[model samples]
Structures are given as C-alpha cells and as structure tokens.
Target chain A: MSDTSFDSQTREASFGDYFALLKPRVMSLVVFTALVGLLVAPGSVHPVEGFAAILFIALGGGASGALNMWWDADIDRIMKRTQSRPIPSGKVGAEEALALGLALSGISVIMLALASNIVAGALLAFTIFFYVVIYSMWLKRSTPQNIVIGGAAGAFPPMIGWAVATGGVSIESIMMFALVFFWTPPHFWALALFMKSDYSEAKVPMLTVTHGRKVTRQQIFGYTLLLAGLAIGTGFTSLGGPVYWAAAVVLNLLFIKGAWTILRRDEEVAEADNYAAEKSFFKLSLLYLFLHFGAILADAVLMRMGVTFGGLL
Target chain B: MTFRPDHELHKRRKGRNIGVGLVLVGFVALVFLLTVVKVERGGSLQGFDHTQRIDMVPQGSNK
Candidate 1:
C-alpha cells in the first residue's frame, strides 16, 4: 500500500475533491435505478419516506466509491484515466477518504433502516461491504472475472429500493438486479478493449488484459445475448407493460447490434480507428441501463393510472 | 511542537473544519427528527388521526 500519510505541502482539499471521492456520476445511476425500483414495487411508500430511502441509498453508493478510491489509490495513481482522482492526485489523503467512507457507510445504513425497513438497510450494508471488501480489495487484482462477479455490488441498489418499499424481495427486484448484473460484463469489456494498456499497466486482471482481445470481444457478444434475453424477459413480468415492452425490444435489438459490430472488428481495425466501434458500444451501454429502468418506471405509472380509471369505467 | 509560519492558512483550515462540523450536526438532527415524525405518525406524516386508543388503563380499576 502507498503511504496513507498526508503531505504537509499539499494544499487544502476543496469540497470538489471530497465530492470526487464519492464518484458522483456513479452515484447518480444508483439514485435513478433505486428510485425506479421503489416506484415500481407492489407496496406504496410515502413521498418523504421514498425520498429518504433514495438519499440513503445514494449515500451508501457514495460510501462505496470513497472506500474503493481509498483502497485503489496506488493502482489509480498508475492508470492515466484515474490518475486525477482525489487520493491519487494528492487533493485528499487516503486516510481521510477511508474515514469519510466508514462514516457515511454507518450513517446511511442506520438512516435507511429508520426511513425504510431492516431488509433495505441490511441490503445497503451488504452492498457497501461487497463493493469495498470483496470487489475492490479481493477480486479486482486477483482474477479476470472480477467485474463479472463484482458486478453484483452495483446491481443491488434497485433491489434495495424494492425492499425498502415492500420490506422484501420479489421477481421484479430480481429481474432488475439481473439486468445490471449481465449488462456489466459487456459494458466494461468494451471499455477494456479500448483502454487495454491501462489495465496492463496497473496489473489488474481484466479479461482484455489476461485473456486477449479476441476472447474479450467474444465474451462481450455472449453476455450481450444473455442481457437481451433478460431485458425482454423482464418486460413480461408484472412490473412491465406495453411501453416497457416496446422500449425493451428496441433497446435490446440496438444493443445486440452494437455488440455484433464490435465482435466483427479485429484488433488492427480497432486500433486503426481508435476503437471506434468499441467506444460507441460503451456509450450505448450507458443508455441501455437508463432506458430500461425508465421504461419500468413509466410502465408502473401507466398501470396505476389504468387501475384508478378502470374503477370509474 | 514545530514552529508554524502560515498562520492565515491554519486559521482558514480551522474555520472550514468548524463549518463542516456544524453542517454534519445539522444533518444528523434533521434525520433524527424525520425518523421520530415517521414513527409517531405510524409510518406516515400525513392525515393526522389522533383518536386511536392507547390501552394504558387497567381492566377494572376504580381508583
């Protein structure tokens, strides 16, 4: 581990540095998916309770980010893409980041339990532990399948939200979890295809680094196929409707096509074009999750309206 | 103790720390208040109906 001590010459850390430690972009995705889960669950949550649930969920996600940054500071310093992160950049000390992460983890878990229920609180706590301890500390440098298994940590927020509303899990929450879980491999592999050197330099066992580009590309296509099935299958569930179904069909077709286009490209072709196809696929993956969750929320709202109006008719 | 020359920097850091501490305390108080409200209202804050029985009395107490 790198020295956790603070540098005396280091300037005072700004609020932005602390915020960067939380990884706001990832936190936004957590907030959005958790909101959709709460909205679509069978039971109703008061608006205030719902807000509190999402807030605590987002805090939990942020805590995980801080802890991940703290643990990964050494490798992060070596990677060009992550070299500017707060701890690596010397804007914040590693010890400070660890302290912030632990504090937020406690506060978020306890507040979530009070605001929602024990199940959601427990799930949030588990999610943090999994991401920080299992994924970041254990799997990240040890195995090529790190992202494949570690993806579960990212996939738990929506389920946590569902649990908050209903005090339990169900098919709807599981499908939501599965969607993110399966989408992670292809989504990350595409980026790995482009940023191969970063993983090699950091000695992280990403599939692209350990197994070669050909194997990684094939895996991306394979996972995308499974993701397509899960995405469409989710549309048939009680949580889905016509809007969600149509959205799922269109989005999955586009995603699969993107994966296929990536699979067809040789490394030479990818390098020549600066991994254009892979980059585009990576961009599409971001849209894929958001649209899927958005459709679920829309479907839930539509179904509620249908039941409310059907009573009058 | 080491001699410190940057007195202004030290003062600024102290001010910032105090500010952050106050904000944290305020946030904790807010969350506590919200939790209390939710529990007292029986898992909700809307539609106050306070006529529910507490069952605090004995079954046949004349005193």
Candidate 2:
C-alpha cells in the first residue's frame, strides 16, 4: 500500500458527512409511507416480517438516493440546495457512494424477498431500477416531466406493502399508488416555483426551468384537480371509511386553494418568493399525504372498533 | 517540488488498509448477527398479536 494521507487530506470526514450519504431526510418519508401501507392493508403479516420488510424498503429507498447522488453529483454541486451533499462536497467519493448504493440495493431486495414475498421483492427491484436508471439517468436531464414519471418509483412502496399483505395488487393498492403518482407533479412543481434559479443553474430541466412559471403554475392546478379526484375516489374503496373521506375532502380543498394562490400571483410577488403560498402548499402537501394515509389507519382502527359507517346513511 | 515520497505514502496506505479491513469485518459480523436473529424469529422480531375485533358490517344491519 502507498501513503493515502495525502488523499485523505484531499477528502474530509464527519458524522454529518456519513448521514448525508444515507439521505436521512428522504428516508424518513420512505419509512413513513411504507409504515402506513403496512398498517392499513387488511390481514396480518408477522410482526417480525413486517418490521424487516419495512427496514429493507427503507434501505432500498436510501440506496436509490445514494445512486441518485452519485449520478447527479455534477448538477448537485451547482445547485444551491444540494451543494453540501456528501459526494459533491468531497466527503465521500462518487465511486464509494455508487458501490455502497449497489450493494445496499442488492441486499435490500434480496432480504425483502426472504422476509416477505417475491411480489414485494420484485416491486422493490423495479423501484430501484426506475429511480436510478429511468429517472436519474434518463428523464431528469432529458425531459421536463422527469419528476412526474420518476414519481412512480416513490409511489411503489405502499403497493409493495400491500403486496406483502395480500400477496398481490388490487384496486385499493393501485389507488394508493395513484394518489402518490398524481400528487408528485404539483408537490415538486411548487418547490420549483421558489427554487427556480437552482434548477436553471444546475441545468436540470425542472418544469419551472424548462417551461415558464405560468405554464408550470397551470399544470400544478391541473394536477391538483386530478390528485383531489383520485384521493376522494379512494374513499369508495374497501380501504376507506367516513374518516378517510372527510380528511380527503378537507385536505384537497386546501391544496387546491394553495395552488390557485400561486397561480394568481405575479412575478414581483412570486419572485419576492412569496413562498407564503408556495411554502404553505409545500408543507400542506406533505401533511396531505400523511393525513390521507392517517385516515386509512383511522378507518382500520374504526373497523376494528365496530364503528362501520357503510350503513349509517 | 520534484521530491518523491512514495515510501512514507506506502506506510500510511498500509495503516489505512488495515483500519478499513477491520471496519468491514465488524460490519459483516454485525449483519450476520442481525440475520440470525431475524431468521430465527420467523423474519420479524415484532409479533402482531394484539387483538382487534373487526366489524365487517354495521351493527344491527345486514349487507
């Protein structure tokens, strides 16, 4: 071996550096949604298998994040919001990140198969491939609809969780999938509204960058309508109850209002980054998804409590 | 600045190599322990044993 202290000096190390590599922030959402899926699905998965499945799902999500970082390091470094990520900051080498990502991806998928079922494992494999290959490698730079298409990768967790329980897909599981899928465009475009410069500087074809803000705003409203319809529609499924329906109605109304506010704002107001509307919408979107899932959870609890609303009028 | 200090570099690299090797061994050992526990427990450590009576239909009503 040759002295690598010189190389070490060229790099840096810290606890935060490693945490950044794992994409902890993104992992939190992955863990949350996956847990909701597991909880709401009818029937039982052994507690051990359930926990293990979720753990592997989270690891798989992190693997995708790491691979995304490795591939997008160039744009990441230029983007203000993403500048301090581990690989771009020289805290971790791109090669190390890639190796860690691939290894984790393999482990997560294989372990999920062993812990749960093949259907869930297959979904996990496809999720990793879709995000790392389709979204990160292709759509991200090549098209303005990157987030819209890449959103499918994020939407798979609940369906995978459903598969773990029911051993297959169904209308209910796919509805959960569609909720996330349709919600992604507007949720992401809202951020794009405020962070317009970052995408432009990074040369990433975010909707706000590739198209004008007016067009982006219009699409946001359009998707919000679509998302609300799907969300409300889920109330009619076996998975839904009165609580879920009420929650969906309230959240969708607020979400549409937020989108409308942004659509109506002018350059001066928007550029001042009156994130008042954009920021609120962004935060509300997070709460909206969580609440929708929470409603499902509440419905499950209600059913278990003998509080069925199907015949209450 | 034309001096070659390859020997010192090699020694330092050897030290790093040992440290990294130990870390990797530790990680593998940890994972092995976790895998054993997971498999023995039938794939999950947390058992879903809580009883919750599910109401398939509304009370006093038939579907």
Which of the numbered candidates is closest to the native, going by highest lDDT? Answer: 1
Residues A237-261, model 2: lDDT tens digits:
9877888988998999999999889
Tell me how candidate 1 scores on lDDT.
Answer: 0.88
Tens-place lDDT digits, model 2, residues B1-63: 597756544554566567667756964664565566655654322345533224533466543
RMSD of 2: 8.8
| Tens-place lDDT digits, model 1, residues A124-210 | 999999999999999999999999999999999999999999999999899999999999999999988887568778899989878
Per-prediction TM-score:
0.86, 0.81
Spell out the clash pairs found in candidate 2.
A2-B9, A2-B10, A3-B9, A3-B10, A48-B44, A48-B45, A49-B44
Q: Candidate 2: where are CA atoms >4 Å away? A: A1-16, A310-313, B1-63
List candidate 1 stretches off by more than 4 Å: A1-10, A307-313, B1-22, B43-63
Q: DockQ for the candidate 2 complex? A: 0.07
Every candidate's DockQ is: 0.17, 0.07
